[model samples]
Target chain A: MTPAEDYELPAGPGRNDNWQGVTPRQAFMRGMAVALTVPGIILFASAAGYGALARDAGFSLGNSVFMMGVFFALPAQVVLLDQIARGGSLMAGTLAVTLTGMRLLPMSVLLMPLLKGKRATRWRYLVAGHFIAVTAWMEGWRRLPLVPSELRMDHFIGIGTGLVLATLAGTWAGFELAGSVPHVVEAVLLLLTPIYFLLSLIASASGEADRLAIVLGGFLGPPLYVAFPGFDLLLAGIIGGSIARFVVRSRGTG
Target chain B: MTSSLHEVTQAAGAASGTLPTGLTLALILTVISLATHEPWRWLGLILGRNIDVDSELFRWVRAVSTALVAALVTRLVVFPAGALGGVPLLVRVLAMLCGLGVYLLFGRRISFGVVTAAVVLVAGQSIMGP
Candidate 1:
C-alpha cells in the first residue's frame, strides 16, 4: 500500500462498526442520503434565510446566488451582507468578511490532511475544497473517518453537491418567497445550523482528548471573545488543545 | 464578460489601465475572497504531507480543530449574530443548555437534543417575545 493509504485512524482493536465494504458508489449514495436528513434540512433552511436577507438587502438574485456559490462561508457572507446592507463599501465588506473568515484557515488546515488519499489529486481538492463550508464541514467531520481512503473524495463530493443544490434551491425559494415566509420564521431558521453543529461536535468527539478540548474551548470561548474579538477561535484551539494534549500525555491516558 | 472586445478594453483601461480585463479582476477577487479562509487548508496539506496520522501532531491538529469548532458553536449560541440576535440572550443560553442537557442525558441523540432546543427556543421566544 502507498504510505498515504497505509495510514489509519487509531481505532481500538476489534472496532467492527465502521464503513467497511463501502464502495465508492455506496459512499456517494450514502453521502447524498446524509444531505437529505435533518442536518441537510437545517442547512437548506438557513440558506433560505440568507437568501431572504440578501434579497431584502436589495441584492440581485444573481449576486446572492453567486456569493453562495463562491464564498461558501456563511459567517463571512453574513458580515459582508450586513456591512453592505448598511451602506458599507466593498473594501469595508472585504475587511469584515476577511476577518470573520480567519476561522476557516484552521478548518481548511485540519481537513486538508484528512481528505488527501492516494489517488486524490490537487485538482480534486481544489474543486471540492470550495464546498468546505460550515454545514458540509461539520457533517464531514462527523462522518469522514468512517470512509475508506479511495471513496473519501467521492463521498465528500456527493455530500457537497447535494448540499450546494439544496442551498441553491433554498436561495431561489427565499428570494422569491421572501414576502410570504414570516420574517420571524426565517430568522428562526438561521438558529438551527449553529445548534446542530454544536451537538454534532459533541456527538462525534472520538476520545478523551477531543472531549477535553471541547470542554476547555467551550468554557473559554465566550470569555476569550472579550479579550480578543475575531481571533478567539484560533486562540481557544491552540491553547485549549495544547493544554489538553499536554494533560493527556502526562496522565498517560491518550 | 460577454461584452465585446472593444468595450472590454475600454473598461479595462478605465479600471486597471495596466491589469488584464474582467477575467483577471474576477480571478483576483476570487483569490482574495478564498484567501480569507483557504490558506490554512493549503498550509496544512503542505505541512501534513510528511506528518504521520497516528502521531502526536495529528492528535494535536484534531484536538485543535475540535476546540476551534466547539468554541465557534459556543460563541454562536452565546454571543449570537444576525437572526439569533433578535432573541434575548437568556433564552438563547437556556435553550443551548437544555439541548446540551438532553444530549448528555438521552443516549447522545443529537437530533433529539436539537429538537428539544429548538422547541425551547421558539417557546422561549414567543413566550418572552424577540
Candidate 2:
C-alpha cells in the first residue's frame, strides 16, 4: 500500500479512506442523528434556566422562549437581560449583547475549514453559519478532520438543525414550567447551562495544548477576577490561551 | 435632546416592560445582512487558505478568531449576569479550577471536568453551610 493509504489522511466515513461502507450522505445523516440525540438532555437544562431567567426578569413566557429560538446565543441573551434588569440603557444593552457575540466571527472562521466543501457553493455556508454555537462548533472541530471536505457542510447542517430544534423545544418546555420551579432548584438549574458548555469544551479538545489552555485558563481566572473584576475572564482566557499556544508551538518547533 | 443617565435607565426600564418585537425584527434583519455577506467572506478565505498554512494572513486569521472566542468566554465568567451573577466570584473560579484539575488528571475528559467542578461547588457549599 502507498504511504498515503497506509497513513490514512483522515477523511470521513465511506469516503474510501476510512472504508466504513457509508456514503457521504449516510455519514452526514448519522452524524446529525447523533448530534440531535446527545444535546437533548443538556438543552432541557438550558431551557429551564432560560425560563427561570425570563420569569425573574418579568418577561413574558412567549417572548423569552422566542428569544432562545431566534437569538440562540445564551451569553448575549443573558447580558441583554442583566443589563436591562440593572436599568442600563437599551442602546447600551444592545451594544453589550452584540459585542459579546463578536466571538461568532472567529468561531465561524475557525469552523469554516471544517464545514466548507471543495466545490460547494457559498449558499451552504450561509445557512450553516447560523447554526454555529459552542456545541456545534466543538462537534464540527472534532468530527471535521475525519469528514470528506465535500460532506462537512451537510454533516454540520444535520447536526445544527437537530440542536436548533432541541433548543426550541427545550425553551418552550422551560417557559411552561418556569413558575412551578423553586428558587433553589432554579439556581441549580441555571448552573447547568454553563456546565454543559464546559463539558462540550472538554469533549472536543484533542491536544495537550488545549488541555493546558483550559486548565491554566480556569486556574488563572479567579485571581484575574480579583485583580481586574469585570475584565478577569477576558484577561485570563487571552493570557492562558496565549501562554498555552506559545508553549505548545515552541515545543512543536523544537 | 440629551438625557441624564437616570432618565436613560428609566426609559430603558419602561421599554423593557414591552416586548422588543422591533429589536427582534431588527436582529432578524441583521442576520440577513450577515447571510448576504457570507459569500464574499468565504471567497476571501478560500483564496487565502490556498496560499499556504504558514502565510502571515492565515496566522492572523487564526489569532483573531481564537482571541475573539477567548474574549467572549472571559466576559461571561468574569462578568456573569442573572443567576450566575448571584454566585460568588471566588466560588465560581474555584469550581472552574477544580473542574480543570479533574479534566487534566482524568485524561482530559470533559464530562469528568464538568462533573468534578459541579460536585466541588456543591460540596463546598454544603461544607460552608449554604
Q: Please report the candidate that would top DockQ against the real structure.
A: 1
RMSD of each: 10.0, 7.7
Across A95-147, the per-residue lDDT of candidate 2 in tens digits comes to 44444454354556567666667635677676677666666665666666676
Q: How many residue pairs clash in each candidate?
A: 1, 3
TM-score for candidate 2? 0.62
**Per-residue lDDT value at A37 in model 1:** 73
In candidate 1, the residue pairs with backbone N, CA or C atoms under 3 Å apart (3 or more residues apart, or in different chains) clash, namely: A108-B41
| Candidate 1 Cα errors over 4 Å, as ranges | A1-34, A49-64, A71-156, A171-183, B1-29, B36-50
Q: Could you tell me the lDDT of residue A201 within candidate 1?
A: 61
Judged by whole-model lDDT over C-alpha atoms, candidate 2 comes out at 0.55
Tens-place lDDT digits, model 2, residues B22-129: 457346434632443233334433443354444434333333323323443444455553444555666666776787677667665555566666676666555542
Stretches of candidate 2 exceeding 4 Å from the true structure: A1-28, A36-51, A90-102, A110-122, A145-151, A174-178, A194-254, B1-93, B127-130
